[model samples]
Target: MDIRVVACDIFGTTVDWYTGVAAQVAALLPEVDPGEFAARWRGEYAPSMDRVRTGEREWAYLDTLHRESLDGLLAGRPVDEPTRDRLVRAWHTLPAWPDSVPGLTRISAAHTTAALSNGGFALLTNLVKKAGLPFDCVLSAELAQAYKPDAAVYHRAAALLDVEPSQILMVAAHKWDLDGARAAGLRTAFVHRPREKGPRQEADRPEDVTADLHATDFEDLAGQLGSR
Candidate 1:
């Protein structure tokens, strides 16, 4: 299919959220090694998502999840609530991948492009403004009260864009998100974010469908997706 729009996930997919979060965590905790703190902080991602995903608790945005996860990571540290609040707010100010702006700009010129991330509308909006992401729209799983890897979130993207799922391309660094999108009937593209796990972090060695196309980042995505 000739894709008319590209819907991308925000965290790790478009921006280096791990690096950004680690950077903030480092600055927030001068006593702790930023790199180690970042690794520990990110380590809680899945279990936290599981709480919302399995209906064990009400669905919450990534912001809340991050906070909940952070509290556990704090381990009775002397850090004040104010600094913690600032750290929680760091999710809103991620520095985009170097390829993010230029690639999205180039892609947007020819295709309708937007963020279809698990990040809430407000959170994603603030990030876009802070990072200068050239997204035409921001769609979130938050709108569906669910997270990615859920078919509902994938379908919501189509309804919000008022386009058929087949016409919208779901691009991500995670195969699980792409698999969900594919199962929900959207085409998929892979943007390799080898650093999503930080230095020497293991990348998913294989993908479900071998990704319709493979690229290193948004810029690579744009180049392969060019003039299509």
Candidate 2:
């Protein structure tokens, strides 16, 4: 493929959101099962995004949507305003996966690495900065007022990068994301993240997806792309 820009997904692809959010939940809501609460909170992600995607609501930042989800998930719980705000902010402080920094550093050295995520701009900015993720640029779906699986997000990324969609390699851990990129005419790379949803839930494997490349993690992805 004629790849130049490497657009990466952030949440599950580059960072360990599950562990991060669960830790916060465990700290704040000692009575609740942290892991289950975290999973339930994430379960609201898609439906919330769909509200905007389908024009049921106006464009809102991922943080706002996350807050809404958190509120709903904690309904009837003894969560205070401060605790709610802290939980929402947890997304901004997610830690990078073990191989993320090294892999992204190598890839950025060889290609124009960029973050292409549905996360809001501030959320993405905070995440990359906090985790020290090595990226040449950050592109959020907020730029296009749309989320992933919406062609506008991918097209906006290509336009911002000043590259043809085919010349941009969209790397993600989710099949739906890669499928969206593929539909938008971008090359796709699927990076397997077996524990993204936690140990009990099975994550997307290479066999479950179709892409130009597949790897166990970002380090393997860098090697596959021949990024030294």
| Whole-model lDDT per candidate | 0.84, 0.92
Give one digit per residue, the lDDT tens place, for model 1 in 1-228.
779889988888888887898889878889987767777777787788878888899998788888888889887888888898999888888889898999999999899998998888999989988889999988888888898888889888898878898998999888878888998999988888777878756655444446777777887788888632
Backbone clashes in model 2, listed as residue pairs: none
Query: What is the alpha-carbon RMSD of candidate 2 to the true structure?
Result: 0.9
Per-residue accuracy of model 2 over 1-228 as CA lDDT, tens digit each:
989999999999999989999999899889988988888898899899999999999999998999999988878987799989999988899989999999999988889999999998888988999999989989999999999989999999999889999999999999989999999999999988899999877878888799999888889999999988
TM-score of 1: 0.93
Stretches off by above 4 angstroms in model 2 are: none
Best by lDDT: 2
Worst 10 residues of 2 by lDDT: 199-208
